[model samples]
Target: MAFWTYMLRCVDGHYYVGHTDDLDARIAGHQSGLIGGYTQKRRPVKLVWWQEFPSRAEALAAERQIKGWSRAKKQALIAGDWESISRLARSRSCR
Candidate 1:
Protein backbone atom coordinates (compact mmCIF):
# COMPACT_ATOMS: atom_id res chain seq x y z
CA MET A 1 0.00 0.00 0.00
CA ALA A 2 1.15 3.50 -0.75
CA PHE A 3 1.30 6.22 1.84
CA TRP A 4 1.45 9.95 1.25
CA THR A 5 2.87 13.11 2.70
CA TYR A 6 0.53 15.98 1.87
CA MET A 7 0.16 19.66 2.38
CA LEU A 8 -3.05 21.59 2.50
CA ARG A 9 -3.48 25.30 1.96
CA CYS A 10 -6.18 26.27 4.40
CA VAL A 11 -8.88 28.82 3.74
CA ASP A 12 -7.17 31.09 6.27
CA GLY A 13 -3.99 30.99 4.18
CA HIS A 14 -2.07 28.73 6.50
CA TYR A 15 -0.62 25.34 5.63
CA TYR A 16 -1.25 21.99 7.25
CA VAL A 17 1.01 18.96 6.80
CA GLY A 18 0.00 15.38 7.36
CA HIS A 19 0.59 11.77 6.32
CA THR A 20 -2.16 9.40 5.27
CA ASP A 21 -2.60 5.98 3.81
CA ASP A 22 -5.72 7.09 1.98
CA LEU A 23 -5.06 10.45 0.42
CA ASP A 24 -8.50 10.90 -1.12
CA ALA A 25 -10.44 9.87 1.93
CA ARG A 26 -8.25 11.86 4.29
CA ILE A 27 -8.61 14.94 2.14
CA ALA A 28 -12.37 14.45 2.05
CA GLY A 29 -12.47 14.20 5.83
CA HIS A 30 -10.59 17.44 6.18
CA GLN A 31 -12.81 19.14 3.66
CA SER A 32 -15.95 18.04 5.48
CA GLY A 33 -14.53 18.97 8.90
CA LEU A 34 -14.60 15.34 9.93
CA ILE A 35 -10.94 15.65 10.81
CA GLY A 36 -10.61 17.76 13.93
CA GLY A 37 -7.98 20.08 15.44
CA TYR A 38 -5.99 22.67 13.47
CA THR A 39 -7.66 21.92 10.16
CA GLN A 40 -11.16 21.54 11.51
CA LYS A 41 -11.67 25.21 12.33
CA ARG A 42 -9.66 26.23 9.30
CA ARG A 43 -11.98 24.30 7.00
CA PRO A 44 -12.27 24.46 3.26
CA VAL A 45 -8.70 23.47 2.61
CA LYS A 46 -7.13 22.88 -0.78
CA LEU A 47 -4.57 20.17 -1.51
CA VAL A 48 -1.59 22.10 -2.69
CA TRP A 49 1.10 19.41 -2.61
CA TRP A 50 1.60 15.71 -2.03
CA GLN A 51 4.23 12.99 -2.39
CA GLU A 52 3.82 9.26 -2.36
CA PHE A 53 6.02 7.12 -0.13
CA PRO A 54 6.64 3.43 -0.13
CA SER A 55 6.04 3.21 3.60
CA ARG A 56 3.88 4.94 6.15
CA ALA A 57 6.96 5.65 8.30
CA GLU A 58 8.58 7.58 5.46
CA ALA A 59 5.43 9.57 4.86
CA LEU A 60 5.10 10.34 8.55
CA ALA A 61 8.71 11.42 8.67
CA ALA A 62 8.19 13.76 5.76
CA GLU A 63 5.09 15.23 7.37
CA ARG A 64 6.92 15.83 10.67
CA GLN A 65 9.88 17.39 8.88
CA ILE A 66 7.61 19.67 6.90
CA LYS A 67 5.64 20.65 9.97
CA GLY A 68 8.82 22.10 11.46
CA TRP A 69 9.60 24.15 8.37
CA SER A 70 9.00 27.90 8.19
CA ARG A 71 6.21 29.31 6.07
CA ALA A 72 8.70 30.49 3.48
CA LYS A 73 10.19 27.03 3.26
CA LYS A 74 6.77 25.51 2.88
CA GLN A 75 5.88 27.97 0.16
CA ALA A 76 9.11 27.15 -1.63
CA LEU A 77 8.13 23.50 -1.44
CA ILE A 78 4.62 24.18 -2.75
CA ALA A 79 6.10 26.15 -5.58
CA GLY A 80 8.55 23.33 -6.36
CA ASP A 81 11.44 25.70 -5.82
CA TRP A 82 14.19 23.34 -4.74
CA GLU A 83 16.86 25.99 -5.09
CA SER A 84 15.03 28.29 -2.72
CA ILE A 85 14.35 25.44 -0.32
CA SER A 86 18.08 24.65 -0.17
CA ARG A 87 18.98 28.31 0.27
CA LEU A 88 16.41 28.74 3.00
CA ALA A 89 17.64 25.68 4.84
CA ARG A 90 21.20 26.89 4.67
CA SER A 91 20.23 30.38 5.87
CA ARG A 92 18.12 28.95 8.68
CA SER A 93 20.97 26.80 9.92
CA CYS A 94 23.34 29.78 9.91
CA ARG A 95 20.99 31.73 12.18
Candidate 2:
Protein backbone atom coordinates (compact mmCIF):
# COMPACT_ATOMS: atom_id res chain seq x y z
CA MET A 1 0.00 0.00 0.00
CA ALA A 2 1.14 3.52 -0.64
CA PHE A 3 1.43 5.82 2.33
CA TRP A 4 1.53 9.57 1.95
CA THR A 5 2.95 12.60 3.68
CA TYR A 6 0.69 15.56 2.98
CA MET A 7 0.47 19.24 3.78
CA LEU A 8 -2.76 21.21 3.92
CA ARG A 9 -3.24 24.96 3.76
CA CYS A 10 -5.92 25.65 6.31
CA VAL A 11 -8.65 28.27 6.21
CA ASP A 12 -6.77 30.23 8.83
CA GLY A 13 -3.66 30.18 6.61
CA HIS A 14 -1.76 27.74 8.81
CA TYR A 15 -0.22 24.56 7.54
CA TYR A 16 -1.14 21.07 8.71
CA VAL A 17 1.16 18.11 8.21
CA GLY A 18 0.18 14.48 8.45
CA HIS A 19 0.77 10.99 7.12
CA THR A 20 -1.99 8.66 5.99
CA ASP A 21 -2.41 5.37 4.23
CA ASP A 22 -5.52 6.60 2.45
CA LEU A 23 -4.77 10.08 1.32
CA ASP A 24 -8.09 10.66 -0.39
CA ALA A 25 -10.27 9.43 2.43
CA ARG A 26 -8.21 11.17 5.08
CA ILE A 27 -8.35 14.44 3.19
CA ALA A 28 -12.07 14.02 2.70
CA GLY A 29 -12.51 13.56 6.42
CA HIS A 30 -10.62 16.75 7.10
CA GLN A 31 -12.65 18.64 4.53
CA SER A 32 -15.90 17.50 6.08
CA GLY A 33 -14.69 18.15 9.61
CA LEU A 34 -15.18 14.48 10.38
CA ILE A 35 -11.62 14.27 11.64
CA GLY A 36 -11.54 16.14 14.91
CA GLY A 37 -8.56 18.10 16.30
CA TYR A 38 -6.42 20.89 14.91
CA THR A 39 -7.85 20.55 11.43
CA GLN A 40 -11.43 20.28 12.53
CA LYS A 41 -11.33 23.74 13.98
CA ARG A 42 -9.50 25.06 10.95
CA ARG A 43 -11.85 23.63 8.37
CA PRO A 44 -11.81 24.07 4.62
CA VAL A 45 -8.24 23.06 4.08
CA LYS A 46 -6.62 22.71 0.71
CA LEU A 47 -4.01 20.08 -0.10
CA VAL A 48 -1.02 22.14 -1.05
CA TRP A 49 1.52 19.38 -1.34
CA TRP A 50 1.92 15.63 -0.93
CA GLN A 51 4.35 12.83 -1.53
CA GLU A 52 3.87 9.10 -1.63
CA PHE A 53 6.14 6.73 0.26
CA PRO A 54 6.56 2.99 0.02
CA SER A 55 6.25 2.59 3.77
CA ARG A 56 4.16 4.14 6.49
CA ALA A 57 7.26 4.73 8.58
CA GLU A 58 8.79 6.87 5.85
CA ALA A 59 5.63 8.85 5.40
CA LEU A 60 5.29 9.39 9.13
CA ALA A 61 8.89 10.49 9.35
CA ALA A 62 8.33 12.99 6.59
CA GLU A 63 5.26 14.33 8.33
CA ARG A 64 7.15 14.77 11.59
CA GLN A 65 10.07 16.46 9.90
CA ILE A 66 7.75 18.83 8.04
CA LYS A 67 5.82 19.64 11.20
CA GLY A 68 9.04 20.94 12.76
CA TRP A 69 9.99 23.08 9.79
CA SER A 70 9.67 26.85 9.78
CA ARG A 71 6.87 28.38 7.71
CA ALA A 72 9.37 29.72 5.20
CA LYS A 73 10.93 26.30 4.80
CA LYS A 74 7.50 24.76 4.32
CA GLN A 75 6.63 27.39 1.74
CA ALA A 76 9.89 26.62 -0.02
CA LEU A 77 8.89 22.97 -0.07
CA ILE A 78 5.43 23.75 -1.42
CA ALA A 79 7.04 25.77 -4.16
CA GLY A 80 9.48 22.91 -4.90
CA ASP A 81 12.39 25.16 -4.08
CA TRP A 82 14.99 22.67 -2.92
CA GLU A 83 17.72 25.30 -3.01
CA SER A 84 15.83 27.48 -0.55
CA ILE A 85 15.07 24.50 1.66
CA SER A 86 18.76 23.67 1.76
CA ARG A 87 19.76 27.28 2.41
CA LEU A 88 17.12 27.60 5.14
CA ALA A 89 18.32 24.43 6.81
CA ARG A 90 21.91 25.59 6.77
CA SER A 91 20.98 29.05 8.02
CA ARG A 92 18.84 27.61 10.80
CA SER A 93 21.62 25.32 12.01
CA CYS A 94 24.09 28.20 12.12
CA ARG A 95 21.85 30.21 14.44
Candidate 3:
Protein backbone atom coordinates (compact mmCIF):
# COMPACT_ATOMS: atom_id res chain seq x y z
CA MET A 1 0.00 0.00 0.00
CA ALA A 2 1.15 3.55 -0.65
CA PHE A 3 1.72 5.76 2.36
CA TRP A 4 1.26 9.49 2.16
CA THR A 5 2.52 12.35 4.29
CA TYR A 6 0.14 15.29 4.14
CA MET A 7 0.15 18.84 5.39
CA LEU A 8 -3.08 20.61 6.27
CA ARG A 9 -3.71 24.30 6.56
CA CYS A 10 -6.02 24.65 9.51
CA VAL A 11 -8.71 27.28 9.91
CA ASP A 12 -6.61 28.84 12.67
CA GLY A 13 -3.86 29.50 10.11
CA HIS A 14 -1.68 26.80 11.57
CA TYR A 15 -0.31 23.70 9.91
CA TYR A 16 -0.82 20.02 10.69
CA VAL A 17 1.25 17.14 9.43
CA GLY A 18 0.33 13.49 9.38
CA HIS A 19 0.87 10.24 7.56
CA THR A 20 -1.71 7.72 6.40
CA ASP A 21 -2.27 4.97 3.91
CA ASP A 22 -5.70 6.38 3.04
CA LEU A 23 -5.46 10.06 2.19
CA ASP A 24 -9.09 10.63 1.23
CA ALA A 25 -10.57 9.07 4.34
CA ARG A 26 -8.04 10.79 6.57
CA ILE A 27 -8.74 14.25 5.16
CA ALA A 28 -12.46 13.61 5.44
CA GLY A 29 -12.08 12.70 9.09
CA HIS A 30 -10.10 15.88 9.76
CA GLN A 31 -12.72 18.02 8.04
CA SER A 32 -15.59 16.32 9.86
CA GLY A 33 -13.78 16.43 13.22
CA LEU A 34 -14.19 12.67 13.42
CA ILE A 35 -10.59 12.53 14.45
CA GLY A 36 -10.60 14.60 17.61
CA GLY A 37 -7.19 16.14 18.08
CA TYR A 38 -5.11 19.08 16.90
CA THR A 39 -6.60 19.20 13.41
CA GLN A 40 -10.08 18.54 14.73
CA LYS A 41 -9.85 21.36 17.26
CA ARG A 42 -8.60 23.67 14.53
CA ARG A 43 -11.32 22.31 12.21
CA PRO A 44 -12.17 22.82 8.55
CA VAL A 45 -8.67 22.06 7.38
CA LYS A 46 -7.58 22.32 3.76
CA LEU A 47 -4.85 20.25 2.23
CA VAL A 48 -1.82 22.32 1.40
CA TRP A 49 0.73 19.67 0.43
CA TRP A 50 1.34 15.94 0.37
CA GLN A 51 3.97 13.43 -0.69
CA GLU A 52 3.63 9.76 -1.43
CA PHE A 53 6.10 7.19 -0.20
CA PRO A 54 6.62 3.55 -0.98
CA SER A 55 7.16 2.63 2.66
CA ARG A 56 5.58 3.61 5.95
CA ALA A 57 9.02 4.41 7.35
CA GLU A 58 9.68 6.89 4.57
CA ALA A 59 6.30 8.54 5.09
CA LEU A 60 6.87 8.81 8.83
CA ALA A 61 10.35 10.18 8.33
CA ALA A 62 9.08 12.82 5.94
CA GLU A 63 6.29 13.76 8.33
CA ARG A 64 8.80 14.32 11.12
CA GLN A 65 11.13 16.22 8.84
CA ILE A 66 8.42 18.56 7.65
CA LYS A 67 7.07 19.06 11.13
CA GLY A 68 10.45 20.39 12.30
CA TRP A 69 10.73 22.93 9.50
CA SER A 70 10.39 26.63 10.25
CA ARG A 71 7.09 28.26 9.33
CA ALA A 72 8.73 30.15 6.48
CA LYS A 73 10.17 26.93 5.13
CA LYS A 74 6.84 25.21 5.47
CA GLN A 75 5.15 28.01 3.58
CA ALA A 76 7.79 27.71 0.89
CA LEU A 77 7.11 24.00 0.71
CA ILE A 78 3.37 24.50 0.48
CA ALA A 79 3.91 27.13 -2.18
CA GLY A 80 5.99 24.57 -4.16
CA ASP A 81 9.04 26.82 -4.09
CA TRP A 82 11.80 24.27 -3.91
CA GLU A 83 14.51 26.87 -4.31
CA SER A 84 13.39 28.98 -1.37
CA ILE A 85 12.70 25.94 0.74
CA SER A 86 16.19 24.57 0.25
CA ARG A 87 17.72 27.98 0.80
CA LEU A 88 15.84 28.41 4.07
CA ALA A 89 16.77 24.90 5.11
CA ARG A 90 20.45 25.49 4.52
CA SER A 91 20.36 28.89 6.20
CA ARG A 92 19.36 27.39 9.54
CA SER A 93 22.23 27.33 12.03
CA CYS A 94 22.91 23.91 13.47
CA ARG A 95 24.07 25.59 16.63
Candidate 4:
Protein backbone atom coordinates (compact mmCIF):
# COMPACT_ATOMS: atom_id res chain seq x y z
CA MET A 1 0.00 0.00 0.00
CA ALA A 2 1.09 3.55 -0.62
CA PHE A 3 1.52 6.05 2.17
CA TRP A 4 1.52 9.81 2.27
CA THR A 5 3.51 12.33 4.27
CA TYR A 6 1.56 15.57 4.57
CA MET A 7 1.73 18.98 6.16
CA LEU A 8 -1.23 21.01 7.26
CA ARG A 9 -1.51 24.68 8.11
CA CYS A 10 -3.57 25.08 11.22
CA VAL A 11 -6.01 27.89 11.97
CA ASP A 12 -3.48 29.36 14.37
CA GLY A 13 -0.80 29.55 11.63
CA HIS A 14 1.25 26.62 12.87
CA TYR A 15 2.07 23.55 10.81
CA TYR A 16 1.25 19.87 11.45
CA VAL A 17 3.13 17.00 9.87
CA GLY A 18 2.00 13.39 9.65
CA HIS A 19 2.07 10.18 7.67
CA THR A 20 -0.99 8.14 6.81
CA ASP A 21 -2.12 5.47 4.43
CA ASP A 22 -5.59 6.95 4.18
CA LEU A 23 -5.07 10.54 3.15
CA ASP A 24 -8.68 11.62 2.66
CA ALA A 25 -9.98 9.87 5.75
CA ARG A 26 -7.12 11.18 7.89
CA ILE A 27 -7.61 14.74 6.73
CA ALA A 28 -11.34 14.35 7.29
CA GLY A 29 -10.73 13.27 10.83
CA HIS A 30 -8.54 16.29 11.42
CA GLN A 31 -11.22 18.54 9.93
CA SER A 32 -14.04 17.10 11.99
CA GLY A 33 -12.09 17.41 15.24
CA LEU A 34 -12.00 13.69 15.78
CA ILE A 35 -8.23 13.47 15.67
CA GLY A 36 -8.01 14.96 19.20
CA GLY A 37 -4.57 16.49 19.23
CA TYR A 38 -2.69 19.52 17.98
CA THR A 39 -4.71 20.06 14.80
CA GLN A 40 -7.91 19.24 16.62
CA LYS A 41 -7.46 22.20 18.96
CA ARG A 42 -6.17 24.43 16.20
CA ARG A 43 -9.14 23.50 13.96
CA PRO A 44 -9.97 24.22 10.35
CA VAL A 45 -6.66 22.96 9.11
CA LYS A 46 -5.61 23.30 5.47
CA LEU A 47 -3.35 20.91 3.57
CA VAL A 48 -0.28 22.79 2.44
CA TRP A 49 2.00 20.03 1.19
CA TRP A 50 2.17 16.28 0.67
CA GLN A 51 4.28 13.53 -0.86
CA GLU A 52 3.46 9.93 -1.59
CA PHE A 53 5.86 7.05 -1.02
CA PRO A 54 5.76 3.40 -1.93
CA SER A 55 6.41 2.21 1.60
CA ARG A 56 5.10 3.22 5.03
CA ALA A 57 8.67 3.47 6.23
CA GLU A 58 9.50 6.07 3.60
CA ALA A 59 6.41 8.12 4.36
CA LEU A 60 7.09 7.97 8.10
CA ALA A 61 10.72 8.91 7.66
CA ALA A 62 9.70 11.92 5.59
CA GLU A 63 7.14 12.90 8.19
CA ARG A 64 9.62 12.73 11.07
CA GLN A 65 12.24 14.67 9.12
CA ILE A 66 9.83 17.42 8.12
CA LYS A 67 8.44 17.72 11.63
CA GLY A 68 11.85 18.89 12.86
CA TRP A 69 12.30 21.45 10.09
CA SER A 70 11.96 25.18 10.68
CA ARG A 71 8.92 27.04 9.41
CA ALA A 72 10.92 28.61 6.62
CA LYS A 73 12.08 25.18 5.48
CA LYS A 74 8.53 23.93 5.48
CA GLN A 75 7.43 26.95 3.48
CA ALA A 76 10.23 26.37 1.03
CA LEU A 77 9.07 22.78 0.53
CA ILE A 78 5.50 23.94 0.07
CA ALA A 79 6.62 26.45 -2.51
CA GLY A 80 8.96 23.96 -4.19
CA ASP A 81 11.90 26.27 -3.50
CA TRP A 82 14.86 23.95 -3.33
CA GLU A 83 17.38 26.78 -3.19
CA SER A 84 15.66 28.32 -0.21
CA ILE A 85 15.42 24.94 1.48
CA SER A 86 19.13 24.34 0.98
CA ARG A 87 19.96 27.82 2.20
CA LEU A 88 17.85 27.34 5.32
CA ALA A 89 19.63 24.04 6.04
CA ARG A 90 23.02 25.70 5.76
CA SER A 91 21.95 28.57 8.02
CA ARG A 92 20.77 26.15 10.68
CA SER A 93 23.99 24.15 10.60
CA CYS A 94 26.06 27.33 10.87
CA ARG A 95 24.30 28.34 14.08
lDDT of candidates 1 onward, in order? 0.97, 0.98, 0.94, 0.96
Off by over 4 Å in 2: none
List where candidate 1 sits over 4 angstroms from the true fold. Answer: none
Whose lDDT is higher: candidate 1's or candidate 4's? 1
On TM-score, the stronger of 2 and 4 is 2
**In model 4, which regions exceed 4 Å deviation?**
none
Query: How close to the true structure is residue 62 of candidate 1, measured as C-alpha lDDT?
Result: 97
> For every model in order, what is the number of clashing pairs?
0, 0, 0, 0
lDDT of 4: 0.96
Poorest 10 consecutive residues of model 2 by lDDT? 35-44
Using TM-score as the measure, what is the rank order of every candidate, best first?
A: 2, 1, 4, 3
* Model 3: per-residue Cα lDDT over 1-95, one tens digit each: 89999999999999999999999999999999999989878988999999999999999999999999999999999999999987897889644
Query: What TM-score does prediction 2 earn?
Result: 0.98
Between candidates 3 and 4, the lDDT winner: 4
Better of 2 and 3 by TM-score: 2
- Over the stretch 16-75, how does candidate 1's per-residue lDDT look in tens digits? 999999999999999999999999999899999999999999999999999999999999
Residue-by-residue lDDT tens digits, candidate 4, 1-95: 89999999999999999999999999999999999989989999999999999999999999999999999999999999999999999999999
Global local distance difference test of model 3: 0.94
Q: Please state the error at residue 80 of candidate 4 in Å.
A: 0.7
lDDT at residue 80 of model 2 (Cα atoms): 100
